[model samples]
Target: MQNLILLLITAGSSSLCACTIQPQAEPVPSRHVSTIVIRQPRGEPGDFIICNDGRVLVFPVAHPKTCS
Candidate 1:
């Protein structure tokens, strides 16, 4: 029937439109070097761990001057 053909055409066009419409992701700012002074009396250089947000890190130190 003509109605059945029209229904099929409408359904196909809706599915094609749904496939073309995609959700976009929000952009995140690029990470840059952010420094924090070692407060502890004994800590070493090059000993660092990154935070979850890709910013704010903790650097452990074993000696006052030499950081490794």
Candidate 2:
């Protein structure tokens, strides 16, 4: 009876050791690119607006003007 109890205890303890604890890996950082839109001043006249992506956009003149 004592040997049976010891065997049961050893089997239960060995099963608990099967699980391993490991530190979680950190996530890799990612790079994001954003586009910004720029509008010309209400009364100012300009040909184009410079963009962050190295492109110049044509500035459309507002019709009938806009209230400040």
Candidate 3:
């Protein structure tokens, strides 16, 4: 029927309009290493140190003020 053909055409048009294409991004090399130091409160979670080169160091909670 003509109504069935019109319904099919409308569905096809809506499906085509819903399609999208995203541009891909090129990866860039890192230049410098980054360092992060975290010192949580005593008896708390702890501390963590991370480097940009995928290095990680973890230590227990300690107070420098008490020792110095």
Clash tally, candidates in order: 7, 0, 0
User: Which candidate do you rate higher for TM-score, 1 or 3?
Assistant: 1
Better TM-score candidate (1, 2) = 1
Tens digit of per-residue lDDT, candidate 1, span 1-68 = 99999999999999989878977677998798798896755535545555556664454455323222
State in Å the error of residue 1, model 2.
0.3
Q: Write the per-residue lDDT of candidate 2 for residues 12-35, one digit (tens) a residue.
A: 887767544445578987688788
TM per candidate:
0.32, 0.29, 0.29
Q: How well does candidate 1 match the true structure, expressed as C-alpha RMSD?
A: 12.0
Q: Which residue ranges in model 2 land beyond 4 Å of their true spot?
A: 21-68
Rate residue 55 of model 3 by lDDT: 67
**Model 3 quality (TM-score):** 0.29
Ranking by TM-score: 1, 3, 2
Pairs in steric clash, model 3? none
Q: What is the lDDT of candidate 1?
A: 0.67
Best of the two (2, 3) by lDDT: 3
Residues 1-67, model 3: lDDT tens digits? 9999999999998887766344557799999899999865666566666756666767665731222
User: Which model, 1 or 2, shows the larger lDDT?
Assistant: 1
